[model samples]
Target chain A: MTEPILSLRQVNKSFGPAHVLKDVDFNAYPGEVMALVGDNGAGKSTLTKCIGGIHPIDSGSYEFDGRPVRVHEPRDASALGIEIVYQDLALCDNLDIVQNMFLGREERSGMVLDRASMEERALQTLAGLSVRTVTSVRQRVASLSGGQRQTVAIARAVLWNSKVVILDEPTAALGVAQTKQVLDLVRRLADAGLAVILISHNMNDVLSVADRISALYLGRMAAEVRRADIDHTRIVELITTGRSGDLGLAPEQTGETGDPDATPAAGGSDPAGEADAIRPGDAIGPVVEPAGPAETPTATDTDDEVPA
Target chain B: MTSVTPEAPQLDGPAEKPAVGGPRRSPADELKGHLQAYTARVRGGDMGSLPAALGLVVLCAVFGTLRPAFLTAGNFANLFTQGAVITTIAMGLIFVLLLGEIDLSAGFASGVAGAVLAVTLTKHGWPLPVALAATIVTGVVIGLVLGTLVARVGIPSFVVTLGGFLAFQGVVLIIIGQGGNIPITNETVLAIQNNNLSPALGWVLFALVAAGYAATRVLVARSRRRKGLDTEPLVVSAVKVAGVVAITAAAVAVLNEERSRNVMVVSLKGVPIVVPVIVVLLALGTFVLGYTRYGLHIYAVGGNAEAARRAGIKVARIRTSVFVICSTMAAVAGIFAASRANSVDPNAGGSNTLLYAVGAAVIGGTSLFGGRGRIVDAVVGGAVVAVIDNGMGLLGYSSGVKFVVTGLVLVVAAGVDALSRRRAAASGA
Candidate 1:
């Protein structure tokens, strides 16, 4: 792969006796969505906190644009063209959308706020992101729905020449349509050559959007699986059991797995809800009909995830 | 049946039910919510017309009621003389409040400055303008020291300013130097308070102020509308402009009052040059607090210090400069007050100057809580306080009663302000 826009290498962090991150090796190349998937205690928050400069790594090197760099604070991170769209969004409820967007960074003309120009620019920013639900840019943020707030936050990150965007569960609480909107935004962001780091727990969402999946198991790097090689059974195994080795609870039908349960004949993702429309190569989970029993994957399948 | 993912939340209806009904309905729930929201907009500092309209009413009523003598052009001119010094002091203090700090020492600092200037010019045989410049410079020095202490030393402003209050009063005592009061008999200095501009010039100046204020208010309201902001009705704006014109005309009439045709006519002669200084200072204060980058930072710091710091604002510098401005303005006021009185005593700025200045700001509708208020708050507030004092003095009230009345006014104004805020907060505006 071409040199990553940023890389986190062998990062270690500890809070007293609790080791939060252990020898983490992570990288994001330009125009790629790198998904980090882990259970609650798998150190996702700690890793991102380190990246966002909320917490400094106890030891390790962070490389950005081919050089080892230190980001000790949010300001430093921003100065390096790294932006994080925090879950809480950090917007003032009392202010209108445009005003909240430019709270401290107001555009000025001579002595005045040059408010007209700022409003026009804010409108353009919103429109550029395809945000259209709200009727007025001057409407107070308090009156906006959750999805709109999320869009605003994401738009703010990308508006300021940001090269690396980290979104923490961007669709965690959004409705299905809103989630669809956000997913579209993520794809567009990466398509425009910006590296996007997506942190999520929803397997369906990870499978749908991520170009590659990196799993962290109890503060250690568990595995990294590129999209083409992924199968649902392997992903579920990695997520639930932290291993793809079959536990021997069921039959071994390992070799070539294909998703036949959902065919494009079922309403597809294009306009229609086609379960079958997922990529032809995607491996559906081993079918366990109520009449049938549980199954396990063989030893060989576990090592298949390591990209060549 | 296809089992759908619970992703499509009941999307359409969260907007429908909240048509803003009153929890305690006064029969018109929708209208009530709209009205409450309007009031909230004003209290939140999102709009300026409310204060302007209310201030105009208060100015008219007070001048009309207290002294039938108040409407004459001569008395109206005298009103400017009364308002001049306080306006300057208040203008400066607004800067301090913008940075969410306070200067408790200004009243005393101004007293000391006034005393020094009067004594130096009259008793020590100094030229008026030279003495004024020197006095203003000393005030600036005092401002710098106090600002540095509060800004650099990390001392709470309350303690620093309280110290200034005490230390400066002592300086005032030294300057007076065993004298109860030193008279300023210099012609130029005395004329600052007593003299008037030509009538045509005075009326023209009044017209200019009225026109400038009206024009600015209209342009601003229009700009807010152009940005798709909620704006007051044009009729409301027109009424506001008319009220300003009427008040200026009435003031001219008050200054033209003849309490005595028998002796030298007790008429307000001309616009006190001090009036223009006060007006210019106030306009500058308003502009800096509302229009400039420094103003936005000040409000940001006041609204939330952590947020301001996180936004990379230099909070310490803003805080220090606020104190400096407050004290320096007080010094300017001292110059005017001492000149007007034709003397300065060690005790000139004592007892009620600070209290009244603060009270005037409160009454004029500047919020004590930092994020809210306007420069005009101080101006209106000063006028209210001045009216009370001047009217009471003319009506033969004793100083004791004056103290009681001033105290009462302060309490009432503060209580009303607090009540309105609580009401707004509860109403979800």
Candidate 2:
């Protein structure tokens, strides 16, 4: 495998008695999208927080460009060209796009805000990103739709020319068209040769965009596999039972198997046909009910276009 | 780009076509578009300076009809002096209010500064500049202590300033000692209230001020257009310039009129010294809050402090600096108060001064919740308060009626603020 642009090795974090992250190992290569997938309490957020420097890890080695480095704060991470587009977007609703784009790091001309240059740069960045939904950079964020706000937030992160950008649920609250816009933007980011760590619960989104998939279960890294080598059933099995045949961590070590009913029904005895066996009717019967125009965007637009 | 309608389906979509919040409008329709957008916003509950402006016009019209003397130049000049101290204090409070914080002690803090000035000048026999400097420094010191406690120590600003309010009042009492009044006799200090420029000089000053205001608007409009940004039409800009000229010309005309009586013709003409000082302060306040990076930081911090912190802004420092500015302005207000009264009495900075300042800020359309106010709010709101008091006095209404009326005005302003905020939230959400 090619060396990753950013890596975290045996990263451990604790909140007093609660061990939020347990010896977590993660990495993202340059020019590739790494999908971090997990269920609730799987420590995906804790891990990302550690990476973003919102929380200092209890013990871990964070490496950048294949060299060990220390990131004690968000500023430190920013200095190293690591930017996190947080789930909340972290934008001021009262400020305009140009102001929000350069919130803290405002450009100035001898004590006054340099509006012309800043506005020009902001316009150039949005144009480069091909963001057409936002009609004006002068519009206050309070007036923007969710998708447009997400676009602005992503544009802001990429505007600083960061080497690695971590997006936490970029499409969680978006409409079908907005999600497509964001996913396209995501691909453009990776195509431009920036490392991207996408944390998401949407399995279809991950499978469609991720070049590498890393699954975490119970605060531990269960498996790190190339996108081509994995299937949906194996990933779900690894998430629920912490093992998918011999590839993942042994199930015995976890001391609890996944739901007995769900395991046999979902993860078939044969590893290769598990996805096929579970699909066709049994898996999607309930979830796909009344699926018409409502599901058309997320289902048809993205589901048919899986990663090559 | 794929969807014809890009707006969120769940959220409130724009009612009109693509013109509102859309890309640039044609130069011919630019003004109309702005008006449409403004009306939409107002309907959506974001009434900007409309209420304060409307209230001022109504008050003037009503008071002018009721009392002939209410519209006189002498009465306005007197109102200007009375509003000066409170306006200065309100201007400083704008900084505090912008951060979604409050300083209850500001009124008494100014009293403390005034007391210090009085004692230093009268008892210690210090020079005017030295006394003024000491008074301002004392105000800064008070601000530093309060700001540090609130920002660094994480105490609630309400509680910190409440403590400051009581403690500073004590300091004021102590400085006054057994006697209640410490009269100020310095010629320069006295001049702040007693002096006025000649009628000719008032016209020149009026011309200069009007010219400056017009120049700034023109320069900003030109720069914005040069950068390919949207700007108001030249006719609209010209209208605004003309409006300022007309207002200043009328004010100068009234003030320059002779106030001579039948027995003795004494011409009490020209703008008061305090008017120009207040104008300068307003200009500085507007510049700092509108044009500087630090001002942008202030807005960002007020809007969402956590977001500002994530953006690498020094949130604590910004919060601290705002408090310092508030306290320093409070000190300036105290000096003005002493100068207006020509004495430093125990009742100088206490009583309803703080309330008036805060009321003026809110009444002027500044949001109490922070992230949405301007220094002009203080000026406009302060004038509203002064006019109410002055008008009531002319009508022979007691202080009791005045307080009740002022309270009602405050409630109405607050209601407007609350209603608009709720509308914005409902639509945004």
Candidate 3:
């Protein structure tokens, strides 16, 4: 495999006394989609922010393009061709699509904005991404649909010739068609030789677009493996219990066998609709209860538990 | 059973409708679509200047009926001059408003500035230019102090400016020497209020301004079309140009009418110098807000500061710069105010002046919520406030009547703003 274009080793970050990320290791290669998945409050945002330079890691070694680098600010990340499309999209509602796209880095001639050239470039970029939902680039962001705004954001990231693109929940609020469109766009981004890090809560989206899956549990890297080697049940096990038989942290470090509720009691039960009826808040209790035993995964176990 | 799909419906009645499901649209159908879209926007609380335009028309009709002379050119020239200072101050207030910030000190800041100008000239024996610069600089310093306290120290602008409002009012009184009024005798400063150009020169200036505006509109449209970009149709552009020409012609014709030949043969009275000064300021303000990068950032910061910061904009710097702009413009407005009154005193740039300026900006359709207003709002709003004041005085109404009527106009204007927003949200849902 080609060397990773971006890699983080032993990255640790904390907010005062709360250590949000601990000894975390992550990497993404060229032309690959690396899916970063975790439950709520599993350090997904902290880890992504570290990579985007919005938060400086307390201790870590970051390697970009096979060389050690320091990213102390967001501009440094941008300088290194790293872009993050935040969950809220970070778009100005009052400005039009073209204006929002070229906002901070407006194209100008002398002192005045070169609207003609900027408009042309915006149109071409949209076309390149096969975005047809918007009838006009001059339409204000406030008037755009959710799907169109997402498209504009994705296009903005890629337009800068970025090498690494991180998307935070790209389809969290989207309809089925929008999800499909964004997933397809994600694949095309990887196909264009850029490393893509997709952070998502949707299992189907990760399964569909991720070349590899990495899971975070309790501020620790629970499992990282090829998409072909892991199934939905094993991924769920890694998420809930920080282990799946031999795939994740060993039993000795967890101080338990990880078998208390690993049988997938809710997996094969009722119809899909019945399972879907399980409210998010209610489901968290059963899934998180088993995770209590795996909270203190030892460093030695994490080292030895890599999938063979 | 050999059931077959029904044949596609033939293209008839309403070619744009789904019966045929074709992309082709007739001009009438396109016009219908445009009208529907426009109505939807209005319903959604994006009324633009519709309410302001209507308010102006209603005021004119009522006032003209009460006194036939109210429609005369002399009264309009007087109204324009009266509105100048408030309009100038309101223009600056729009900058602060666009950032979702308020500058309560704007009225008294200008008052202080006018006092400084008066003292520097009468007591210090300074040149007119020196006095003007010194007064303007004082305004900048006051703005800088307020902006820093608000932006860097993180004090709420409402609190900071409110403090400044009272502090500056006291400062103005001190500068004018404890209840003393300083009469301004400088010809250049006094001319802004009293002087007028010849009738021919007025027509020439109006023609030049009108032509320039129409040319810009046409040129921009042509360039956009040439670049294969979207632009308004030629007929629409022509109609807009025609509207400008008509308004300019009417104003010039009315201002040139003979007011009185017995006392003084004052036929062909032209617009006051203050009118042109306001126009120049408006043009500059519009250019900054609409055509510049800094202006774009102001809107973005006002709309969503978090998003703006994430996008790498210097949100603090933008916020600070706007306060400075507002204060500097307030100083200029004070000069106009002093000119109109022909003197500087403790009364200059008091709370009343600030109230009028705020009223004008709000009446002009600039949203109190920010990120949704225009420079033109101050123009229309200033005119509305001035007309109210002027018409009431002409009718020999008491100050009480003036206050009630003006208060009602402001409430109605604010009601229109709030109601349209609520209705838009409901319809959008």
Candidate 4:
């Protein structure tokens, strides 16, 4: 990760002694979508907040673009080109699109709001990001669909020239079509040369868009798996079991995969190709969720490629 | 870059963007596709005073038919002059209401300022305008203290303003002392309410207001069209302007109505000049709440104060300013009322005056719950209350009857505010 856009090393946070984040290390490289996967209470949000400048880490530090940095507030994070669109979206429903987009920093020529300039800039920002679903930028957020609101929030962050964009569950509330729109937007944000950190519990989204995936288990980073090295099945297994002993990285590598290094390449084009670099067979390592009866992970799943 | 479909239509695309006129674009055609994309949204649903405006018109007719003399030029002039003070105070109250608070001290503060002015100007022979300025400043100081307590100290506005109400009423008594009636011998100040703007000036002033309204509507509509921004239909704008002009012309005609009496010839008093003054105040208040970001911050504070604060608005300052405006307007109303009566009694602005101020705002469709309502609501609703008082008095209804009617109107108006709030909340505003 040649001078990653943002790096959080040994970050620790606690609320008076109820340890929340414990020595968390995370890094996001420019132009790559990294998934921060975790179970409930795994401190994913806490770790992100530390990076977002919403919380001060009890220990460790953050480095941005090769220099150690201090982010004491969201404004600091913003000035450092870091932007986070939290789950709530923080939009004023009474305000129109242009107003909501520029809630904190309004563009003014003098004493008056330069409505024409703001509207023009907002439209340009949205267009530059290839956001097309929204018809009227003057419409209130209350009238927007969930996908459109998410798009607006994401567009607002990118419009500020943010170098690192963090999105917490951008598609958590969307339906099928809407989710597709948001996932598409996520891809474009990274492609536009901004490092994207996506926090989601959904495996399909992680599999579809993430270039790299880091899983958090019990307040510690369990593993950071490059997306090319693991498919959805292996990723879910690691998320659920903290290891994929019984489930090989893929069916093609299932038999005689004692040495991952011995294998030439695991389908070079696929996201699982990087996971194939994991040195195999050294330690199966006391993993949880041993294949058991009454635990069929695949049967009841509705999301694409995610088992029950 | 991955799965974004170009087939998806652009919602807020600019016409001149991406080089216009080259391939008849969907984004361009889509811009032509009309939608109810924008509305000023000063009020949503039933939060405004269309009902109150209609009620005002009907109340006048009913009173006129019942007493016949109730709609005479002299009585109508009396109604407008009376409504002016309440409307003025309610305009101030609108600001406090926008910040989701109430100022119980307004009535007493109003009395205190008027008493202060009377003592300084008429009794001590201080320069009239200077004395008035001193009195208004005192009112502002009192307001500043209350505002500081409510905003900086984090004391609830209810407790702070309630304390102010008691303290200021005591102060008013101290100012008035043993003086039973303070005669405002100032002739120039009396003209604001006592004398009309002379019928020609009155009519011309009203015509300018009408023209102003028309020009503003046209300008706004043209600006929206020029920007290719979505706004209400042009016909809606025209109809709204036409409605104002019609109302102005009708009011002037009504003031021009004459009644022939056995004792003397009666003709409409030709629009009390105070009407235009009241109109100007309402317009100023509307402008502050509409075009300015300060107005936007007020709505944001009222809607969800925590959200507004997090958005970095100076909520405390905005909240303090609102209370100050409210109290200052109350002082303005006090002085206006004193001039209208041509004399100021020691106990002039009693509990009833404050109650009527609250009632005017509430009945005008201002939500007592706050975050909603318009200053114009007070103008229309104050007109209704004044019409009722004058018409009922002319019909020989006793003061007791007036009290009962006023109480009933307050209860009904508050009930409406509650119901409308419940509906809006249910609809997820």
Tens-place lDDT digits, model 3, residues B311-343: 879999988888898999999988888888889
Q: Which has the higher DockQ value, candidate number 1 or candidate number 4?
A: 4
TM-score of each model's chain B = 0.81, 0.93, 0.90, 0.86
- The deviation in Å at residue B285 for candidate 4 is 1.5
Worst 10 residues of 1 chain B by lDDT: B13-22
* Predicted model with the maximum TM-score: 2
Off by over 4 Å in 3: A253-308, B1-37, B260-268, B423-429
Q: Rate the local accuracy (lDDT) of all candidates.
A: 0.68, 0.80, 0.78, 0.72
Q: In model 4, which runs have C-alpha deviations exceeding 4 angstroms? A: A1-3, A127-135, A143-148, A172-181, A231-308, B1-47, B253-273
Whichever of 3 and 4 has more TM-score, that candidate is 3
- The DockQ-based CAPRI class assigned to model 1 is incorrect
The residue-by-residue lDDT of candidate 3 on A104-215, one tens digit each, is 8888778777787778778777766555556678776776656667778988898898999999999887766667767877887898899999999888999999988888
User: Which residues of candidate 2, in runs, are more than 4 Å off?
Assistant: A1-3, A14-19, A57-61, A252-308, B1-25, B262-265
Q: Rank the candidates by TM-score, best first.
A: 2, 3, 4, 1
**Top-DockQ structure, candidate number:** 2
Would you estimate the TM-scores of all the predictions?
A: 0.73, 0.87, 0.87, 0.80
Q: Candidate 2 lDDT, tens digit per residue, B55-173?
A: 99999899999998999878988888989988999999989988999999999999999999999999899988899999999989988999999999999999999999888888888
- Kindly report, for each predicted structure in the order presented, the TM-score of its chain A compared with the true chain A: 0.76, 0.81, 0.82, 0.79
lDDT of 1 at A227: 67
By summed lDDT, the worst window of 10 consecutive residues in model 1 chain A runs over A263-272
